[model samples]
Target chain A: MNIVVCLKQILDPLAPAREFRVDNEKKEAVRGAASLVTNIFCENAIETALQTKEKLGAAKITALTFGAADAEDSLRKALAMKADAATHVMNDGATNPDPLAVAQVLTAAIQKLGAFDLVLTGRESGDWGVGQTGALLAELLNTPYVGFVDSIESADGKLKLKRQTDNGFELVEATPPLVVSITNDEHNVPRIPKTRDVMMSVRTPITKFTLEDLGVDVATIRAGGDYYAVADLSIPVKDVQCEFVTGDSLEQKVEQLAQRILEVTRAL
Target chain B: MNNVIICLFASAGFDRATQGVAGAGRRLADALGGQLHAIMLGAFTATDEAALAAIADHVSVATELADYQPETCLAALTQLCQPLAPRAVLLSNDTYSQELAPRLAFRLGGSAVADGVELISHSEHLQVKRAVYGGKAVATIALKRNPAVVWLRARAFEPAAPRDVTANVEPAALTLTTNSATRIVERKSESAGEARLEDAQIIVSGGRGLGGPEPFEDLKALAATINAQVAASRAACDAGWCPPTWQVGQTGKKVAPGLYLAVAISGASQHLAGMSDSKVVAAINTDADAPIFKHCRFGIVEDYKKVVPLLREKLAAARQ
Candidate 1:
């Protein structure tokens, strides 16, 4: 089995809110002192791929990413986790491309890489949180798509998946040459790579491709009006002033809080 | 007339979220001076039909789509939309629509945006405001294609008011080919009867400071007293103190209830992202300096252990 996982490098989502800043002119987040890390969902995807490979025993897993040079670090982490190979599609144009452009670029890279039985991606990136890339990529790739899958197992030459739904879960079966977007589950938490594997991952050879190499036009993607454009980006100002319920005793405070809760619920 | 098509999931059965999307579509259609068209997928109740008829100028029901088969639904929608040439396609942000919006947009040669909290309609285009960077910031995007496809966050818009006049209803003209390569083998549903976090008007959420899983039971008791749903912060859920399904954060479920009562949570940005849309926020925490105080409408600086039980008792007594 041939499995390919798509990874993304994004600003650490856990960073303090005070430190987050956006450049309105550029319609992008100001990176500033924030550090970059692998998107947690992508790490979950990598973990899912690794576990799938482990179950199949003979499957080869490849990690792929489309980002600046710094994204190599995410690929390295995936390699340390036991992926067989890695590919980097260098994105030199817009720092953040819309989902359609991303799907187009990823489709080009995947086609250039030849045949694959399955393609996996994080359900959504931590940054924009658009949650559309995997579905769009499936459309562009002309493959069957599944979203919010947490686990995959091989079943009689097919893949069995545990898909998360709003209500609960569904057990699904899909043929090979499928696209799936993985959501995080306790079973798929990304494992930490060993120190030896980390060092070896740094030494591993990674294939690199440019947009031109994939026959994708950077200008077309960078053109603002073709698909969608960020008209404005700003922090919404919330003017909520908290009224603290004060009391000398805990019971008094609880009484006051209950009274306030009743007031609010009654208004609702 | 330029029509705005609102897609309703019959599986969801005209819930508030569906009604909210219909309201959003009605607003867009009014802004465009166009007709509101509702396309109901799957089997719908009579209440669903009446409600859709009251809000929309026209209603189309595709009963053949009784279940959510992505490929089949996509084909049916694509076929239904080609002749309508709508100004925009609206859907509620749910698992099915989240999966369908982008694919439908791709098929229709349009652009798709998800989780929109605000929609701005211009004479020739539309703009969407959505949260990004874990809800610390908002981005307003302008769509550049025709029939802008978008899914709106729940509770962002009011549910459509039923008008006195009924709309024309007819079966949709669609040719569905179910050549899906994927099939569901089985389904496991969570036990019903408990109030869902999204639909609850009041939510009582706990976080890392609650110490352990035992405290969540106290929180649940308090929630039960008020008929609210119990949720947990990402920190609590990550520690396995509660089910991940009960997690409310940027990566988890986004809930915008009438009142959000937080306990022991320090209010991380990701956590704030999920509940920032809440109408009223109240917190009970030992740390007065916790960031949650900044966004809350009411706050109490005390240990939740002492406050929760007493508060629950007071609320129960008041109800009685």
Candidate 2:
């Protein structure tokens, strides 16, 4: 079996809320001091693939990412965790392409890689959280897609998955050449790499591809080429002010807080 | 092309989120000065049909669907919309709809934006404002194609109240292939019928500061007093302290309720992403500098262990 896991490097989502800012003029996020890291859910996807590889015994896993050159760091992390190979599709087009363009480039990359039994991605990117690439990629590649997949069991090209929904979990089945967007769960926590593997993985060579190499024109896949447009961006203003429960003791504070909440909401 | 279609996904029946989608769709239709239509796929009872008819001008039920697979849904909705050429298609930001919205848009040669909290009409364009960088900022977006498809955030608008007028029921022309590549084999309830976080009027969420899963027992006790839904942050969920279903953060369900009470949470931006839309937010944490304090409407700087039980007692007493 062969599996391809899509990875994304996003600004640390765990950063303090105050550090995040949007450049309204540039229509982009202001880079903060928090360093870039592989999106948490993408790591979960990698872990999911690794778990499947362990269960299958004879399987190769490839970590693929489409982003600026810095994305190689994410690929290396996947390698450190024992992915067989790393492929980087450099983003030479617009700085921030929409999900459609991203999916198109991914489809091109997957086709270039020849054959794969499965393709996996995070449920959504931590930055935009659009949750569209996997399904759209499935459409472009003309494959079946299952999103919000939490667990998977595969045998003989047939895969059974447990997917998360608002109501609860639903069991679904699909064949090979299927796309699945994985979500983070206790079972898929990414493993930490040993120091030796981290050193060796850093030395491993990475395969690189450009948009042109994938036969995709940069202009057609850039930001403004898409049908959707971001007209404006602004920081959301909060009108409600924090009314602190002033009290001397913890008991008093709880009483004050409860009374205040009930007074404001009148739910009682 | 001016009609607005609201794709309804009826679970056991027409839940609150479904009604909210209907209301939102009606709002968009009214803005465009167009008629509102409904398209329901999968199993819907007679009561569901009657309820839908009371809210929409026309209701189209695709009776052939076995389940809510995206391919079958896209095929059926395409057949319905291609002839109608509706100006917009609205859906609730539930799991199925989020997955279906973009693919449906792609098939229709239209555009999609997910998790929109507000919709406004400017001239001939529909402006949708959605959260970005978690909930720290808002992006007002415009779709450059017809039949703009969107998934409105749950609880963002009031659910359409049932009216006395009945709608014209029309069976949709469904062109479907039995050779669907994907199929739902079975469904099991991960969490039994508990208070749903998306539909609850009040939400009480815990974070890493709670120490362990045992403390959630007290949080549940507190929730019982206020009839609030219980949730947790990624930290607690990742720590194996609680089920991920109870996780409320950028990765979890985004909730906007009448009141949100944060206990022991440090207010990571990702956690705020899911709850900042809440109308009135309050936090109780040991640390005075927890990030959630800045975003909330009230704060109680104290240990939640002592605070939760007392608050519960006070709330129970106050209500009496």
Candidate 3:
């Protein structure tokens, strides 16, 4: 079995603050010192794919990404964590493209890579958290797919899938060559990297795929693209002013904090 | 029974809002001339069943020895759905539902749509409404077939209140003829948030006018005194002061809490799209012309730093 983990690098939700300098420039996020992959949900996808590879014995793991130049880090991050190989589809300055086009672009890369038994991605990316790319990709491919996976079981060449919902959980099953998406919550805590492994993984060969390589259609990618539109990005202005909490004592400060939380809870 | 099987995800442990979302689904089902059939796959406990059955009509539960394994539950649903195929499926747009809605749709051979806001049915086909393009446009989705699974973003729609119907509970076991290769080596929950942003009923949000993230503390203090969640405009969230979950806008959580207290949040269309529908909005900002002031039922054109602290002081006094 061959497994592919689809990844999208995003502006870290907690990225450091940067001023938006131009009409086209997206609002800069605070990097917060460390650049992380998209939403944590993708980690679950990678974890599930790697686990399946281990079980299959003769399976290989392929890590794939499509984003701006900075997003190469996401591919590197996937490598450091343990993807057998990594590919980054570079579209300069396309840090945030329409998600549908992004998925379509990635699917083109998948087509180039040829056959795989399974494909996986996180439920949503963090920056936008639209959660549309995976389902949309499955639609484009017309493949059997499942997401919000809690667990997957296979036996006798049959597969079972469990999906997480709001009130409780749900279950579904499908055959091979299926696409699955998982959110971080459904699975357990992700793996931590050994220092030696992280260093080596980042250094490993990460193939770079581009518009020419993945065959991005001019109609679908540029302005007046089939799926999305580009608009100006604006940074919101800021003003900070506040009166200090004037608690007479430390105990009083604690009481003030509790009172504040209680007040917020009670406003309902 | 024209049942709409509203499935939810039961993770390793229980979430406080699961019951609330279930209760809301029950109300929605009842209003639509349908019954809410809640389903669960987990290591069942007495407490779990009790909470689940409270909001569902027929609770089909499959208990597992392991923590709600994905493969086991998927296999179980494949079997269970065959016996209990419903008109439509509703799940929260949380991580689990987002994943399952499509997979379940694939297994049942039905059309699946995610992040639906409204479910309108005509002639056995359902027309689902969902936000597209990051809240830029509302798309009406036509369900391709029967039993189409539609996942609604949690907190987007209001869960109806519970009715007086008695919930029926049954024990189910998945005929898991397969074993999954993925084993959870370790599972960790995100840092426990003091406030469940999805569940909060009262929100106090700041905006670019707050100057810096520093003044958000005043809004936080004010909100805490009133028992409210802290929210932000896109500018604030994008500024990296508040998390995205705390953003109330078209692209963010559409909140209708009883009272939404706005401190310095300018209501942009994108931002207003989320909060404009709130039950009652009260905004305190220095700019009277601020867009948020127009949508708000009560508007106070004053410095938030002054008014927020005063409001906090009043609430604190009233509680005592």
Candidate 4:
């Protein structure tokens, strides 16, 4: 089996809320004190790919990404987690391309990489949280796509996928040449890379391609052409004024809090 | 006439979220001076039909759909929508619609936007307002293509008011080619009967500061007194103190309740993303400067352990 996992490098989502800043002119996040890391859901996808490979016993997994130079770190981490190869499609176009544009670039790269049985991506990027790229990629590739899959197992030359739904779960069976977007699950918690593997992964050479090399028109994607245009981008003003409920003792505070709760619930 | 189409899958019947989408569709249709059309897949109740009739000018039902097979539903919608050439295609932000919106847009030569909180119609195109940067920022995106496809966040808009005129109802001529390569083998649904967090008017959410799973029982007791649902922050879920389904955060589930009471949660940006749309927010945390305090309407700076039990007792007594 051949599996390709798409990873995205994003600013650490766990950063303090106050530290988050955005550059309105650029319509992008202002990278301040927060460091960049592989999107947590992308790590879940990588873990899913590794587990699928483990179950299949001989499947080869390739980690692919469309990002700037720093994104190589995410690929290297994927390598440490046992991805067989890494491909970096340098994004020299828009800093924040729309989902369709990203899917187009990834489709070009996947076609260049030849045949693949499976393509996996995180359910959504932690940064934009648009959650469209995977479905868009599947549409562009003309492949069947499944979203919110947490686990995959090989059975009778087919793959059994456990998909999370709003209500519960559905166990699905699919043949090869499929696209699946992985969601985080307890079973697919990302494994920590060993020191030896991390060192070795950093030393391993990664294949690199620019948009031009992949025959994608960077100018077209950067122009924001017929695709949706950003009409406005700004941080929403929160006008909430918190009134602290105070009392002399813990019991007194609880009593006051209970009164407030009653008032709120009564209004509801 | 220019028409706005609301695509709904009624596998579990038309839900409150679906009604909100229909309401949003009504707004769009009125803005565009167009008819509101509803295309429902799967079985629907008479109440669902009447609900659609209240808002929609035309209703099309495809009851042959057994389950939400993405490919088949995509095919059915693509086929149904080709002739309508809708001004905009609206859907609820559910798992099925999230998968369908983009592909259907691509197939119909349109553009798709997901999780829209607001939709505005113009002479030529539609603009959608959606949260980006994990709710820290909102971006207004203008759809430039035809049949602007958009999925709206649940509970973002009021349900459509009942109209005096009944809608013209018809069966949708759906051509479904099942993709034999992919099939659902088994399905499991969470046992129902408990109030869902999304529908709960009041929510009591905990976080890492709760220490462990034991406190959740107290939280549950407090919730039971007021018919509130229990939720947790990502930290609590990650620590294995609660089920992942109970998590309310950017990555978990977005909930907009009437009153949200957060206990011992430091209020990370991601957690705020899920509940910020709440009408009222209150927090109980020992930290005087927990980020949650800044966003909440009321706060108590005390250890939840000391406050929760007494508060539950008082609430139960008051309710009685």
Candidate 5:
């Protein structure tokens, strides 16, 4: 079996809130001081593919990403964790592409990879959380797609998937050559690479493809400057006032907290 | 003939959450001075028609679907919008809409903006207000194409109040093609009868400060006293203290409830992205400097074990 897991490098979603700044003039995030890291959920997607390979022996996994050249770091991490190959869809790092453009570039890159039994992506990117790539990729590829998949198993030459919904979980089945957007579940947390393997992963080869190579124009895949305009970006003002209860004892603090909650909720 | 369409996903009947989408769609359509219409695909009953009639001028119901399938739903919505030449299309920012909105935009050759909190008319163009940089900043976006598809954030708008109005309920003309790539085989509940985190009026969430899963039992007890739902931070979820489905953060489900109570949570920005829109927030933590204090309206510096039981007791006594 062959699987392709789409990985993305994003400013750490776990970065301290104070570290995030936006350039309103440019209408994009200001990444001057922050470091980039693999998106948390994309790692889960890679783990999902790896776990599938573990259960069904003799599998090849490819880590694919569409971002700046620096994204090779994310692919190396995937390779370190056991992906057999890596591909980077190169993009200019200056502009932040919208979800649609990202999906289009990914679609083109996937077409360049020839054939694969499965394609996986994070349910949503950490930064935008638009949650559209997998769906648009499926549409562009003209294949079946499912989102928010937590569990996957192979049965009778088909894929059995468990999707998380607000009410509960749903069981879905599909054939090969499909796309799935994965969300992190207890069973699919990414494995930490061994120190020796991490060291060796840097020497692994990564194939690079540009937008031109994929038959997509750089300008067509970018957002905000011409296609749409970001009128403004600013810090939102919080309307509520936080009242810190001045209670020396634990019980007093608890009581005061409860009383204030009731007073505000008009429950008493 | 309405020039604005709101696609609703309903099975058996229109879900209450879809009403919120209808409210947002109506607001945008009204602001644009365009006719409002609704499109739905699933088991549609008369009750669903009546509910939609109160909200939209016309309702298109596709009764051929046995389940909510994004591909088929997109096909139906695309067919419905083609003839209307709609100015905008609205969908609820649920799992289904999250999947369908972008694809629908692509199919229609338009642009999309997801998880928008507010919609307004700015200089004759529709602008969307959305949170960026983990809820720390807001960006107002304008689209350049027609029939712009948008996923309105849940609970961000007032659900349109029901009124007495008769609307035409016509069968939608959509040719849904079956895709061999995927199909849903079965569905089972994770925790039956528990309040859904997205729909709950009040939420009681725990964090790593709880130490283990056993405290969630106590947390659930307090949740029961107030008719609130139980949630956990990403830390608790990642530490295997609770199911990831119960996690509320940037990676988890976004919720905007009437009141949110964070117990032992440090208020990371990822967690704030999911619940900052909550009408009122209160936090209980041993650390006074937890970032959650800055975003919440109330705070108590104490261990959750000591505070939770007392809060339950006080709330119970006040109710009685």
Candidate 6:
């Protein structure tokens, strides 16, 4: 069995999230990058893949992603997590798509690769949480997909999925050659790479694919700017400082904090 | 006075903390001397028959969904609202409600406000108060009149409890159609944080400054220590430091917590626009001139690096 995961290298938010050029038309903070380190959702995807592979005992897990050259760092991280192989698509393409385009590109990539038993993606991207990619990808693949997933257990050649839906929780089961998006938050945190394993990940052989290689037109990809928008982004000009209420001493500070809480909540 | 319509996610099985809104809408309608109509779609969840009806003057349910589809749900709501011509169409901002709200107003060609908190000054320009700037400040929004529609973030308001002796069950018979473009073929669940941000009493948010995903550990530690939930600004989520589900801004989640703490965040107007209405906001930033300071009742002009760790330590020590 073969499982494929879709990922994108984003700007690390910790670095100078602010970068501007003479051409102001393109001044987005580092494209939501810092989230690359086994993001909660991605880790869940990897975990799901690993679990399914374990169930099959001889299954293979492949990491697939597209992004800047630095995105290779994330690919290496995936290798450290014990994925059988990795694929990085580094080329000029839409940094963000209308989710549909993303699905299309991912679908095209899947077709290019040999058929797989399962295709996995994070329930939602760290940057844009439309929860669209997985659903759209599944729609394009004409396969079944599950979302808001916290855990997965396999048996009898069937994968059982649990969903954290709007109201609460529900469960679904599906066969192989299906699409499953992993959910994240608190339930399942991604495992950190050990120092020894981390060093070895960089040495793993990684396959590189481009839009041309995938036999897909880059024009078909939608620009991130068009799919959604950040209309007015700016720092507020106002300044509202703390109104200290005589918390001169430690005990006094606690008391004053309590008093302020009352004032803020209008309990006073 | 105008008629009231409490558009519910009863079909979606009630989302987030929509129970609060259902309860609150009943109270608001009672206060305004209007008929409180509880619109339950799909099947009823509440076991007590009388308890459900006490909140509203009347109860309506739509069922046999054919299947759970968004377009089908929206079309059902449009048909329901067309004949009623309600003064305000209230909705809960769930995964489906968020999509349903704008379309409901659009299908009716009426103006609507999403993520509304309180119906402040509803005469003429039905103004509402919402949280913004990471729950630091509150802003007033005036809804365009006639048939005003509003979508409140989940848990924004409390559901009305039934005050009457019993609920009068009225089943709605309607042919609901759906768009074939989408379907829910699979769903899976993962272990999640303590409480959904919308339901938490305390929220801790991080901005672009935390540096990386690992630092979220510190924030998460602080939240665990204080029994608080974690949230993030659009900038942080946009930069990939955090997931969009945790984002707090105009384009993200709107939270009105009892206490909102923002670390390393330079309060961008867009981020603040979604959280400004938080009851008490505390901002910790290195930049004293950061816009977040203006809305905070407690400003710690120090590096979040030192502040977050120290805060975690202090909170832990105090708890111990």
What TM-score does the predicted chain A of each candidate obtain versus native chain A? Answer: 0.97, 0.93, 0.78, 0.95, 0.91, 0.78
Candidate 5 positional error at A120, Å: 1.5
| Tens-place lDDT digits, model 5, residues B1-320 | 22788887665245445677888887777777887888876646767678788889888877775477655666767887888888889987677777778778878877788888888764645788888767878888787766678888777777887768767888888788866567777878776766456767788999989999999999888888777889999999889888777988787878887789999999989889988988788999889889999888888877888888888988888778
Clashing pairs in 1: none
Model 1: share of true interface contacts reproduced: 0.81
**Model 4 CA deviation exceeding 4 Å by range:** B12-14
lDDT of 4 by residue, B151-173 (tens): 88777777889899999788988
Give the lDDT of residue B22 in candidate 4: 86
Ranking the candidates on DockQ from highest down gives 1, 4, 2, 5, 6, 3
Candidate with more favorable, higher lDDT: 4 or 5:
4
True contacts kept of 4: 0.82
Which pairs clash in the backbone of model 4?
A: none
Instruction: Summarize candidate 3's per-residue lDDT along B74-170 as a digit string, tens digits.
Output: 5567677767767767776564555456556656766666665566654446666654323333445556556767776445565444447668787
lDDT of 6 by residue, B21-48 (tens): 6776676666566766767766666663
| Candidate 2 to native Cα RMSD, angstroms | 2.1
- Compare the candidates by DockQ and give the number of the best one: 1
Q: Which ten residues in a row have the lowest lDDT in candidate 1 chain B?
A: B191-200
Residue A15's lDDT in candidate 1? 86
> Which tens-of-lDDT digit does each residue in A1-268 have in candidate 1?
8888999999998888888889988899988888999999999999999999889988888899999999999999999998999999988888888778888888899999989999999998878898988998899899989899999999898899998877678888899798999998889999999999999999999999998889876787655226677889998888999999988888888888999999999898
Residue-level lDDT of model 2, residues B115-136, one tens digit each, is: 8888887546777889887887
Residues A115-209, model 4: lDDT tens digits? 99999999987788878888988988889988899999998888999998766788988987989999988899999999999999988889998
Ten contiguous residues with the weakest lDDT in model 2 chain A: A222-231
lDDT score at residue B254, model 6, on the 0-100 scale: 63
Question: What residue runs in model 6 are displaced by over 4 Å at the alpha carbon?
Answer: A14-24, A30-38, A165-170, A185-188, A193-205, A212-217, A220-232, A235-238, A248-252, B1-8, B11-40, B43-60, B65-254, B258-279, B282-295, B299-320
The prediction achieving the highest lDDT against the true structure is 1
- Against the hidden true structure, what lDDT does model 3 obtain? 0.62
| lDDT by residue for model 6 (A58-176), tens | 78888887666777877888888888888877656555444545666678878877898778887544333334566556656766555556666666767666655543556556676
TM-score of every prediction relative to native: 0.97, 0.94, 0.58, 0.96, 0.93, 0.58
